[model samples]
Target chain A: MKKLDEITKRMPPEFNDFYRQRIDFIKASIKNYFPDQIDKDFLDRVVGQPSLFEPDLKATYDTIFLPTQEYLGRGGKVLRPVLVAMCLEAYGADIRDFEPVFGAIEVMEDSSIMMDDYIDNSLTRRGGPCGHIAHGYALANVSSCTAFALSHYLFYNNELKLPDDKALKLLDYMAWEHIQMAFGQIEELYWTQSNVNDITVDQYLQETIARCAFLTFRGPMRYAGILADAPPQDIAVLEKIGEYLLVGYHLKGDNLDMSPDSPEWGKVAGEDITTGRRTLLINYLLDKADKQERATIESIISSRTEDEEKKKVVYELVLKYDIFAQTRDLAAEYNQLAKQEIEKLSVSDEYKLLLNQFADYATRRRSL
Target chain B: MLHHLIENFDTEFLEAFEADQRTINECFEAEYKKLSDTEHLEQNVIDEPLLAWDYRAIEPGLLELMDPFMESESHTPLLFFSILRDLGLDPKPYVKASLLLEYSYFALGVIDYFDFHKVFTERKQDLLTYSELTQVRYAAQYLIQYPRYLVIKNSFELSKAQNIALHKLYATIGVTTGIGRGAFLKWGHDYFVSLIREHYFQNSIYTLNNYFLFPAMLGAIIADLSDAQKDSLQKGFSALTMFAKLRLEKRYYENQDEFKITPPIYRDLWQLLSFPGMALMENGLQVDPAPYAEDKYPWFTGLYRDLNTQIQGIDMADTIKTMEKLETELFETFVSELGRVDLLPATVERLRNCYRM
Candidate 1:
């Protein structure tokens, strides 16, 4: 795990540049769009307490907002959204006007991560208490709501300035994204409660691909493609790039399941076990092992012991089958595929640089 | 948008409302006379302390947009009318309220989902202007704020009127029964109890909770404490705890798949985690038969009272006589609609289930 530190440290710099390039332009565009500030006081009056309308404002407005803004304001990886901006930048389209597009998307991604961590019940992210743990459930719940509101508000605000047809389409796209995410959550919840054979590893992988990763992953590429007004074939390729990144992100959870450096998900470790949440790791181990070993794993999993040593031993047994290496190989394969797609594009020199940079940065980052 | 709203509300009911305003006015005046006699009745006053729920303002712009509707009731009392106007629909206050009741009974929680909400929701496209959302938002806000409005309206109406016909109206209907004039105390008890039962139901849960809990908690808090201190914070705490317990109980049934795995009670589960709101209603009255009959009525016909002229125990022997000439007419209007409440009919079997063994 210590040996991996160098890779993690080096990984974020390119992402930082990626996001900075985005926010700088976003700040300007949003300013141009709304010359005056939105009057936070008015928003506060409408929001009231943290009801469904004002979820995150109710939850993490006090707790996570300050820190999250700082974290975001300071240098960090803007890998996903930057890819989107870069992809658009690569295409022969001018997108300096669409800054809120990036800010709103970043907000959505942050919410997804915050919520995912809570669901995973893993503690810590970027080396701090998980949002749920620090802010409390109400706050965490609100944090998600805030992101949702921002998305809707952004769509609403944008709708006013854009053509009515395009505004509706934008809303429709958002609704589609929400439904997909919700469907994915239902699948995960079902797997968590029911038997393994009832669940499919491929389905889990696919959900991660389409829902979690695709929204942000392909968002950049598609955004870039659309902004640059690229060919449909290029858009299709960008979608695949998103699918690749999603699968790679799920591998980050492999550390939570099979690896020894257990903080892999921080505080939320053992959440899946506590929740009986099935993942590919458990599915593979069950498939590879005999009935008795499967039963052994089931029993230990059911107990949900917090004992690190005991869980570690079980994790080690699963690891012996070379699961992590297998997962990594799959990741590498996707990376190659993504590269092939990038190669076909007659993108600008700047886009080519961004594509290569994101590919390397994604390949290096360990956790989802 | 306002024109569109007016079109949806153009029903035979409005014509009758127009034709019968004088009759309705007379009916209310007659009832007001009797209510004046019973004005000092012992039951309506709350001995227990109370406080307002959170002093939340309606979204500022929305409230200003809705203020005109709240002023529409020069003929009928403003208690129920403001609810409609306060909400952004065309300002037929009672008509809108009655319509809201239709949705309130069964479509409440289901409406929270975007699709179901379309019944209550203006299409996002339809709501092109910011003022449109403000209007829709306030109209909904009026419903959400129904209790406070009801309290204000009821107290004002009751103080002026002498007829108890309005009292009878509340005893029979679910819509106007909540926060009606003080004579509807019996009706209120029944209404709240039925609400307690239905509040566990998904379709009714959120609306009932939002409608009923907001006021009950507000009243419980306001009755005891002042605006400045709200010293009845403990009662507020109790009310909140009670609400949460009911919420968890509802959730237990709501998530049936997960419910199967969950223990029947949230007590142990909550205690382990120290849920902030447990044992909320421990101090309140623990009456048998769940306190009030689950099947609420707009009128409480007395079970017993000896008539001066009757020999055999007259059913109406013990009945409390109507005090106003117009009371009879007001009571008639309420009865006419009893059979038409199509949402979920109060069947004999349902009533039995709500009753004691």
Candidate 2:
């Protein structure tokens, strides 16, 4: 696994500098926005009564606040927030003006991940116990519920005090995106729970778009466009760009799941297989493998085999079928398409170049 | 004679009210059929393992459970349609929108029930397996959003502004329910205060207002109702919602087994009921259970009278007396407020029946 610095070093110097500046600000801003602990006075205001017993504070911290920080502190790529700012910049809006809403993206992502991890029964995330495992299901679940509610604070309590019409539109957009996300999760859960293997590439792609793409790129990008009041045509272009980038980004992450050093980068090698996730790679392999090979792959995926030897066999099949190389090409193809979409945008050359660089970084990044 | 309460009212009013019920029930049946169809995924089978427990295999049974459970909460959807019809607007277009609202609220209710019972009671274990609990939750998440897709797909009839209102309505409900659920699970003075501030003071009110007002807002915009008319309708529906929630909670409080109520839980409930109005001022929050609340907020006074009654478990005849008095007073206030509005006679009767007055 590459160090964070090494990953940045691989990016073009200009984009690297741009990414670092905004990424640092996003990280710091998220840190500043989430309170470390709930003080007694803060509790009093929320509870509405004068007398708050001491135990409530401890319970609140244990159930909601602490578990939330533990999960958020594990560090994500902050890709969504960065994309939000970049989209704002493309529209020639001052990203600083919308700083508060950035945490909205982060908390929403954190909240979704915590819930998703629980649903999937994942053991590890970002090289630590999944929230549900680290903090019992009750605490993890309640904390996630809190995070979901608090995600709205960034928009509702924005320092700018957006006009009612605009504010309503933004909130509406977010809700619609969230509803789409739930549909996405339903399909993914159903596919795995049903142990369904013959998932067509289109079926797989649509699920990925709904589950990962919308929240990760499309939603945040459109959110920025709406906030900037970008032209509808440009916003449409941004949406396509986000969709393409997500396809590329998601495929690359799938390939990384089998990398030997995935654990070093806070991923479990073959975790998708064990969880029976119908990734594009798995679907592609299932489609192409011979009768015996298909049977073997099916057996492994359906059983959620934990045997290293069995996982290695699936990895060998991946190589024999050249699935990784095919995935890389597909990812590259999508990344190029994303870059092409960016060219259609009316944004300035610098912003276009930045968007294109990030497009490359979508597939080029070493770690998931 | 009591059952014929609406027979003496205008025929058009009765027809509209019945039509709303029929449409809501139709929507529920449609959603139920779609969810219970077991062959949803036929050709996409991974070689069936020798033994595998599938969540989908039990979906039919779950829907069977969900069907009756949803029917029991039918009043909420009725209230929505009643609000629209009472305001003299067509409730047809927003029937699906009301379905979206219904599923959203019910989904959150299921989550609250599961999460709270998982901690507080072992009784749910008899009713649902761990897998059933989780799978039901996943199904709920799907149920909540499927109607929104229907709304969007059928968007030709809706204006962009109306669509935005629907979105805001769903989002506010989701956020507020999350706050309410979190607050319900955590027991502490601070947690209670936070719950009061976030859930009651802000989120819950926003949610209830949205639920009651979305139809009115859409109807007003469509009918070109004057602002004064809109304001009057809004006040009536909001008041009705407030009273309904208070009544619902009062019933829940009535069912409270004192043996199950621990020290902290008991104390928290007590403080919430007896919280001094001035304490809110000290905390920079004003207590406003107004318009319906005359001297003291009905929430405090209504619950305070029966504070000891809960712990006494109705064993003492005095306990039941206090409880009945509070119930009668709350019902009278609700009926009085209903009278203040310009609702059709049938709409008012439906609400009385729906709220079990």
TM-score of chain A by itself in each prediction: 0.78, 0.90
TM-score of chain B of each: 0.21, 0.54
What is the alpha-carbon interface RMSD for each candidate? 23.8, 9.1
Judged by DockQ, which candidate is best? 2
Name the candidate that leads on TM-score.
2
Off by over 4 Å in 1: A1-76, A93-95, A256-271, A344-346, B1-357
The residue-by-residue lDDT of candidate 2 on B120-237, one tens digit each, is 2221222114334555566666666656654344342655454544454444445444443444344321223433332342323332433444444445544545556555555555
Report model 1's chain A TM-score. Answer: 0.78
DockQ of each: 0.02, 0.12
For each candidate, what TM-score against the reference?
Answer: 0.49, 0.71
**Segments in model 2 whose C-alpha atoms lie over 4 Å from true places:** A1-7, A31-66, A138-146, A153-172, A260-264, A288-290, A305-309, A366-368, B1-17, B27-73, B88-93, B109-136, B149-165, B188-357
In candidate 2, what are the lDDT values of residues A227-313, reduced to their tens digit?
998999988888788888888888888888876443445756787777667777888888889999999998888776567789889
DockQ score for model 2, please? 0.12
Q: How accurate is chain B of model 2, given as a TM-score from 0 to 1?
A: 0.54
Error of 2 at A75 (Å): 2.9
- In candidate 1, residue B284 scores what lDDT? 20
